[model samples]
Structure formats: structure tokens, C-alpha cells
Target: MVAITEMTNWAVDLIDVRKTYGKAIQALRGVNIQVGRGEIFGLLGPNGAGKSTLVKIMMTVVRPTQALGTILGRPLGHRGKLAATGYLPENHSFPGYLTGAKLLDYYAALSKVPRSVRGPRAGELLERLGLSRWGSTRIDKYSKGMLQRLGIAQALMNEPELVVLDEPTDGLDPVGRRDVRNLLLDLKQRGNTVFLNSHLLSELEMVCDRVSILVNGLVARQGTLSELTERTVEYEITCVSDVASLAGKLLRLGATVAGPVVTLPGHDIAKVNEAVDCLRSANVAIHAITPKRVGLEDILVEAMGGQDAKPSATPPTSPPAARPAGPHGDS
Candidate 1:
């Protein structure tokens, strides 16, 4: 295990982390990620990727058998840091017989919250998370949204600096999803770092300060949403005049003209100017020029695969099917 003192930053850091299940089952391969304090970092990958494995390691639910990393400035699995870090697993299984208040109290104890402060804090969390009314209800009766809220409350019981959430809004309705998104924003405002492991590209795009995308157990890309997907679209110059002559000229200049629009692709200023010069010389009447911007999902698809990209027309209320299973399995 690496020493916690090795890292200068007190934020989360994973250096050359690797994990494997058996001789052939490799879960992570040289995975490295760094997140600054008070930043929302997103872990993105298709099903069967190593996002969950990384989160599990961070939470100490499963030890990294081969690789080493640290969380909240302490070596991962360091008991001292566990109290300062909170985790919400993707599939949580709390004692169904316990009331919401009791469940949170149990977690508070496990997190080593002072006995005197535990009860009051539990009540405060229940009220803040919109579960005060249901605090007396048994966990077995709680709806999915209610349970998710309680899960968040439990994770926040220790006033942790790093909150790791896996699919926080997986089964939520539109309103519920929005509420959880707002909760994440609230956490950010309070200067807490959220390490969110989710496949919901749109949601991550909305909230994440930075994102790391993994493929085949390796980090394919990592950066802020803007840096990863930033690109200038092909300038669309719509004209009203006949483009037959103009098309020929554009083709000679290595440009493509279709119908009334001439596509000046690439981000080369000189190339765009040359194409514009050719069009102007042909007496083409330019009616409109539009530069389309690519969305985060667009860039994700380009980097990962077309199959993982969510259809734009599909409503957010209905999430798309899981990404097709890769060789290792669905993440």
C-alpha cells in the first residue's frame, strides 16, 4: 500500500491502479484518476467496464488486490479516511425491518459519529433529504426514490469530504432525477467532492466538473466535458443560386458541396477562407452560415462507440438499453 503522505493533494488520487479477478478476468489495467477537492468528477464507461470496480476499491468494499490508490489524501483502505468518505453503492441492501431513522442511526454509528451527536444529525438529515415524514416508516415500505434519498442521507451522515455515488438516480422519475441533480449541486456548493460513477451521459454532462472515460479496463480519455468534446463543426454556407458550377469549383479545392449548402469541414482557417473565396468568386448568394456544436454524448460516442450513444429523441424519463455486452461483460 502506498503511504498517504506521498500525495501533496488531499483530494482523491489513484496512481497506476490495477485489479484483476483471476488469470483471465481483468477488471482494471493501469487505471489512474485525479480529482481536486470540491470538484465533481464523473467516471464514464459502457457496461462491463471497470467503473464499478474502481468505486468499490475507493469505498474499501473490495480491496485492490494488485494496484494501489488513495482517497481523501489517505491510502485507500486506511481506516482513518473512511470516516471522512461516504459511499452509496449501486445496489444497496439495507435492513428492511429498520425504520429510516434507525437505518441512518446504524450507519452513523458505523461511521463513528459521536453518540451524543448521532440522533440529532440523523433527524436533521432525514428532514433535509425530504424523508422526515417517512422517518418512522420501515425500509421495506420505502419507494425507490425514497430509498435513494435515504441512501444519500446515510452516505452524508459523517459529513464526509468525498461522497462516492454509483447510479444515484438510476430508477428515478423526471422530478426525482431533477431533485437528486439539485442535491449534487448543493453538495458542490458546500465544497464537497463527488466521485460519481454513472452511465447517464446527459446528467454527468450537466453536473460533472471533470470526467474520466474507461474502455477495456484502460482510461481512454480524461478531462473536463468541454476539453474532451470541443470541436468546430463544418461551416454550413447555404446559398440560393445553382451550386452545380460552385460544386465543381469546391470539389477542385477539396471541399464538398451538396444541394444549396457547401460544407467547409475541418478547423483550418486557411482552408475555410479558400473555400469562401471560391464561393464568392462564383457569385454564389450566401443566405446563412451556421456552425453546429457537438454535445457531450456526441463526443462520447466518437470516443467510445456509436452503440453507447443515447438517441437524442428518446426522452430522459426512459433511459436507453444498457450498452451491448463487451467481451468482459456489461459494466
Candidate 2:
């Protein structure tokens, strides 16, 4: 039996979900993920990490070897439930012969959108997506960015409660990306759930309420952005004069000297003062001192077992105050 959590309206609730391809290519290995209602959740990983497979399973495009969960509070693969869900797959293809407006109308019809509402909704979405002038133009002539925006519009054509996008911003420039980000926030404000799969960590960091980093078909880490990132805080101090010579003295003050930059634990204000005092005593030129926050990318790289992660001077503490009470998360 699936465990019922406090989040009764979970957008996604899966337990020990597993998928395998052929006999040896295991795409997912009993993974667990829960996305809350109306949340902008992100899934990130390098290529071949089963991110796409996960999405496909959710969309019922791929049948999992084993899955025990509910989507939108309904049994997985319930066709009727799909009307309330929207999906924008990676590299989406639209009919080249149809005009942008007709394209949306066609999809709306497929979703059984009311004929009366389809026309106005299509126009509204085109205007909202900055494609109002191109509505009459054939999709074949639309640029890659335009096509991407249209893909989002088509996904929204049915006013779905849950929107799943795989690399939604794959072809957009900076401005286009910003527009999509703003649009995502707007959707969140409207109380729609968004499940995003993207390789762009920075973009996810900017918009996601929570994220999961999947590696080798397993979820390495998953939690709220702040919960995953705020592990250790360090204060950075830059000194140009004889930093190498003062390394020993700085170490004595609970500071680590990395070239001319000295990092002191953020919790220790006394060490910061002591570092300054020592620098002043040695006639050192202090350039800057700032808190060095742990970013999401840093944590992800560390989770991926990359070599760039810096070792903490202090021993690690208990894992972040138990990811905010809600549906179960990756342990």
C-alpha cells in the first residue's frame, strides 16, 4: 500500500518506481519522487541519467517495469486523468501546414476544449506568448524560439492542472528564456503545478521551489532549493600582500588560506575579526571579505562525485532539518 502523506493534493506521488529497457539498460532503479500541488519542481541530470524515461513514464508513453503510486490522485495511466495534464516534450514537432492559431485550435480540439472557448483561448495565448502577429503564419516558417513558445502554448491550451515540460527552453535566447521564466511564475501564481526537466541548473535555481539531481538512474539528492544548498557557509576575505606567508597565522585563527583568499566559517564572527587583526598586524592589503554561500550547482556537482567540490573544514552536520513536512522525498 502507498503511504498517504499530509500533502493530500500531491501533483505526483510515486514510490519505488522502476523502469528497465531490454535486459540490461536499466533506466530507473526503484526511484521515489513526490511533487506537491502547484509547485514548480525541477529534475536535473546529465544525458542518459533516465530523466527522459522518468518523464515518459509519467506521461504514460513508457510503461515502467514496476510502479506504485498515483498521479493527480488517480491510478497511473488513467486516460481520463490526462485531460487535466499538459505535456511539452523535448524537440516537439508541429504540423508544418497549419497556421500557428490553427495549430493551437487543433490541439484544443484534441483535448476536447469547448469550440466556443478555443478560438479566444488560442488568440489570448498567442498574444501572451508574443506570437499574436504570427498567429496567421504557418508553423513551418516559425523560428526555433517561436516554435518553443508555441509548444508551451499548446501545452496550456487545455488549461491543465499539471504542466510537464522537458527542456522547455531548449532553443530560446536570453530574452526568450526570461519570458518563459516569467510565464512559469505566472502559472505558479495561478496555482498550477509545473514539473520541469532541464539540464540548465541556473535556470532551475532561479525558478524552482525544489529540485532533484538524478545520476546513473538514481536520485542522488532532492529537496527544496534552500534545504539542499545551505549546508555550510564560509566568509571570503581577499588579501594581496604576503598571503602565503600569513597562511599559518590565518590557519591559527580558524581561517583557510586558498591563495590570497581566506575563508572563515560564517558562524564565527570572532575568526573574521581575528583574520583582519592579523592582516593589519602584518601590513597586508585586504581587498575584500564576503560570505561564500554554497550554490545549488556546487551541491549537485558534489552529488555527481565531481572533483571540484571543496572539502569542509568542519565535519558535516545532520542532513538539513528534514525536508519540509509534505509528501515523502528521496532519502
Candidate 3:
């Protein structure tokens, strides 16, 4: 294991990290990633693309069979640093016999929370996560959303500097998802580092400062959403005339058209002009043209070698809101 010097800066840094499972399953391939303190970083990828493996390596839940990395300025798997970090795995189950309060107490003790502060802290977190009424309920009785909240409460018991959450909103109803988003914002305001691994791209786009996308066991793309997608511009144009016939022509000319609109995919000025010329030549009078901001989901799909097709229905979109809504997330 290589030693880490100066633990005062980055909360997490990966230097050529690699992981392989069994004979041919290379879960991670020579990946290099870095996350600064107090930043919300998202690890995104398709199913089976190593997002979970990478997170497990970071939390020391599974040792990387190859390569190296550091967390909280200590080499990966360092026990001392692990104590200062909290982790919520994708599929977590607490002991069925224990009440929510007891489960938290047990984990807090393991986390070395002071004996005098554990009770109050547990109560505070229960209240904060909307679990106060169910403190005495056994884990077996808790609903999926409640269990998820309890999982988070347990992770925060020690007030760790780095919090890693995988699929944090899975199974959560709209309102429940909104709550988690709000909690993440509060954590950021308090200057804590949040590393999220999720398939929920909308949530990631709203909360993350930077994101890394993995493909075929390697980091295919990583950066701020704006940075990875900065060069791609999509515009939704609506015209009074039914221009559906022109879609095939626009696509052949390097544009994507869906239903009532045609979209130019890149930021090249010439391409935009070319589309305009094509439309004009076809005598298609434009009714409206609005820039369609690319999102984290859009970039991840494209990076994963997936096609950018128009969705079943045009998704209802509002300009980015200042704060993301809770579990019943405005759905």
C-alpha cells in the first residue's frame, strides 16, 4: 500500500485504481478520479458498469484486487480514515429484531460516538429524518422509505467528514426523494463531503458538483455536467407546418429529430447554420426555437454508447429549481 501524505486537502483521490472480479470480470480499469472536500460528487453508470465496485473499494467494503487510491488523505482501506467516513450501501438491511433506536445505538457505539452524546444525537437525527415516531419500531416493521431514512441516520451518527451513499433514493416515493435531496443540501451547507452513487440522474444533476461515468470497467467520462456536455447544444423547434417529413433528411445531415422538432446535436456554429439552411430550403417556417440544456442523464446515456432518442413523451421540464423537492419529489 502506498502511503498518503498531507491528509489536509482532498477528501478522496484515486490514482490509477483498478479492480477485477473472478477470471474475466474487470470491474474497474485503471481509473483516476478526485473529489474535493465539501463537494457533492456523483458516480454514475449503467447497470453492471462498476459504479458499485468503485464505491465499495472507496469504503473498504471490498478491497481492490489491483491498484491504489486514498480517502480522507489516507490510503484506501486505512482503518483510521474509515472511521471518519460513513457509507450507505445500495442494499442495506439492519437486524430485524432491534428497534430503530437500538440499531442506531449499536452502530454509534461501533462508530465510537461518546457514551454521553449517543442518546441525544440519535433522537435529533430521528427527528430530522422524520423517523421520530418510529424510534421504537423494530426494523422488520419499517417500510422501505423508513428503512432508507434509518440507514442514513445511522451513517450520520458519527458526523463523518465523508459520506458515501449508493442508490439513496431507491424505492422512495416522490415526497421521500425530495426529503433526501433537502438533507443533502443541508449537509453541503454544513461543509460535509457527499459522494453519491445512483442511477437517478435527475437527482444527480440537481445535487452534484461533479460526476464520473464508467463504461466497460473504465472511466469513460468525468467532469462537471456543464463541462462534459458543454459542446453539445439541443434546440426544440416548433413550427405551424407539420415538418415530420423533414426529420429523416435532418438526421442524415447529422441532426436528430423527434416528433414535432429537429435538434442539432453539437455546439458547432456551422452545424447550426447548416440546420437553419436545410430547414429554410425546405420552406419550413420555424415557430419557436429554444435551447435545450443538456443534463447529467443525457451525458451519461451518450457516454454509455446509448442512443439519444426522444422519450415516449416530451418530459415536462421546468428551469432548475433552487432546491430539489423531497421524496414525494414534486412527482
Candidate 4:
């Protein structure tokens, strides 16, 4: 178990959280997670890893067998703090009879937002989410992607300081996903803390400031992306000439040769230099030398004990956008 340390700067602090069903099915063993204020934190795990259960516990939607911590600096289940928080649950079911605008107003009212504040906020969020033209359209008339967008808009109706989203981009296409990523960044710019739970590792890699990997209800790993991937740094050298001939020499220098490429694990520059020198001595032409850090998918695979667990479908790549720097200056 990872030791839990109390920190006052956290927007969400969870300690020793556990949940069980019918005394036999342990959904969560013991989990500790901390999210800094004004940052985007991601929660990722394989199916039945208690990701949704944990989120529900945080949102006061499901009762936990044991839990201790604070949300927004207040004790668990604090009414005022909960009112200040926003949440969008997984597989949400909204009333289809209500129009998009009416739905936002209804949700905001439930959060105790003033009637006057609800209208303007609803309009602003509708426009922000690209639903201005569909404001009066009934939710049943909206597409799956549009409903997902409306769900996110309703969560922000109260202008929460801490937003907990479960699969916010589940039904979104490439463009919709890109828009959601931008919206998340905009929330961070406004000093809002976001706790994101999703199965899409690529999307999380693009936006999360830090992440926690859970396995069988336990936290297998947790930290900033840099912290988690630091040990996974490796260098790949592609050669025009066959690398088989130099395998024996490169092996002595802690490098593996396969076909026309040499793989060197770790960040040892001297080893790479020696390998290059060995290849040069053999008159092998070098095509490219690339450095890489293992991605979130790689980390998740390792956490799952090398099992062949598939994450959600990866969306098409889009142009990179400017992102906020994480604690380690990487995002």
C-alpha cells in the first residue's frame, strides 16, 4: 500500500478509501489519491478496477464502507463544498423531454444556483459548448455526441471550483474530443481543478497534469507524467546497414540489435556514444537516432502485470495545442 500523506494544498484528498459489494466482491481495497488545486488530474484503470466506484464515492452518489478525506478543503459530504463542486457521471441518464436550455437550468437549480444566474450561465455554456443553436431542442432530438456535450455543460452550470468528470468524451468524435480538450485547458486557465476519469489513455496523456493508475482497487502507480515515465527513457538508432553483424559488439555495450535498429534502454549517454562509435567503426550508415519515453498505455500495461488489457479506442491525431505546464514542467 502506498502511504498517504496529508497536504493542505490539495483540491481533493482521498485516503484509505475502500468499498465492497455483498461482502465478497471487493471493488476497492485501499486507495489514496491527491489532486492539486488548479490542475487536471486523471484516474485510469482497467474495467472493474473501481474507477467509477471511487468517483461515485467522491460525489456522494454511492455510500462507501470506509473513506476519509476532504473535497475542496472541507470534510467528506460537506454540503457547502459539494454545492461548490460539479460532477458528470458515467452513463448518465438525463430527462429527454427537457430542452437543452431547460436541462441546464434545472441542473443549476438543483445545485442551488440563483434563477437569474442560471439563465446567463446556461447561455454562456451553451455557446461555449457549441450548442447555442440547439438550446431549445429537446435532448431526445440531440445526437449522442451532442448529449455528451450537454452533460459537460450542465456540470459547469454552477461554475464549480473542482470538476469531477467520468468519461467526459465517451461518445465524442475526433473534433468533439479536441474541443473537450480545449475546454479542459480553459477551465485550468480559470483556476479550476479537474478530476478526470476515463479509459482513453491517449486523451489523458494529452491533457492530464498528473495521473493515477489503479489495479484491482489498489493504486498501482501515481505521479506526474514525467515522474511515472522517467525510468522508461530509451534511445533507438536506425541503421541503413544490417545490424546483425554488429550485434555481438553492441551487446557488450548494453544494447540490443534487431534487423537494422539498435535499442538501448535507459538514459546512459555514454552507452549510446559507444554504440555509435562501434557502428561507425563498421561503416554502418545511420538513418535516425530517436529518443522516446514510454507512453501512458505502456505504463498501464505494466501496472496490469503484463496482461493484454486493451484500453479505449484511440482517436485520430490532431495538431498539438499549447497546454499548461505541470508541476514537472511537462504536460
Local error of candidate 3 at residue 157 (angstroms): 0.5
Question: Which regions of candidate 2 are displaced past 4 Å?
Answer: 1-7, 239-248, 254-260, 265-270, 280-288, 310-331
Clash count per candidate: 4, 0, 16, 0
Residue 12 lDDT, candidate 4, scale 0-100: 90
Worst ten in a row by lDDT for model 4:
322-331
lDDT tens digits by residue: candidate 4, 1-331: 1123234878999988999989799999989998999999999999999999999999999888999888888767889988889999998889999999999999999999999999999999999999999999999999989999999999999999999999999999999999999999999999999999999988898999999999999999999987976653667777776989889999998888889979887777778778888887788867666555667887898899986533223221222342221111121
TM-score for each model: 0.81, 0.85, 0.81, 0.87
lDDT of 3 by residue, 189-215 (tens): 999999999998889888999999988
Question: What is the per-residue lDDT of model 1 for residues 1-331, given as tens digits with 9 covering 90 to 100?
Answer: 4554455564788877788887778888889899988999999888888899988988877767665557776777879789998899998988999999999889989999998888899899898878899999999999988899899889999999989999998778888788889989999999999999989888998899999988877888889876775565445555666687767778866668888767665555566667666766776655555443455666667667676443233122212333221111111
What RMSD does each model have against the real structure?
8.8, 7.7, 6.6, 6.0
Give the TM-score comparing model 2 with the true structure, all chains together. Answer: 0.85
Best by TM-score: 4
Screening candidate 1 with a backbone cut-off below 3 angstroms (N, C-alpha, C), the clashing residue pairs are 47-330, 47-331, 48-330, 48-331
lDDT of 2 by residue, 121-186 (tens): 999999999999999999999999999999999999999999999999999999999999999999
Candidate 4 residue spans exceeding 4 A from truth: 1-7, 240-248, 283-285, 307-331
In candidate 1, stretches whose alpha carbon ends up further than 4 angstroms from where it belongs are 1-7, 237-262, 270-290, 305-331
Q: Which candidate number has the best lDDT?
A: 4
Give candidate 1's error at residue 212 in angstroms: 0.6
The deviation in Å at residue 141 for candidate 3 is 0.9
lDDT of 1: 0.78
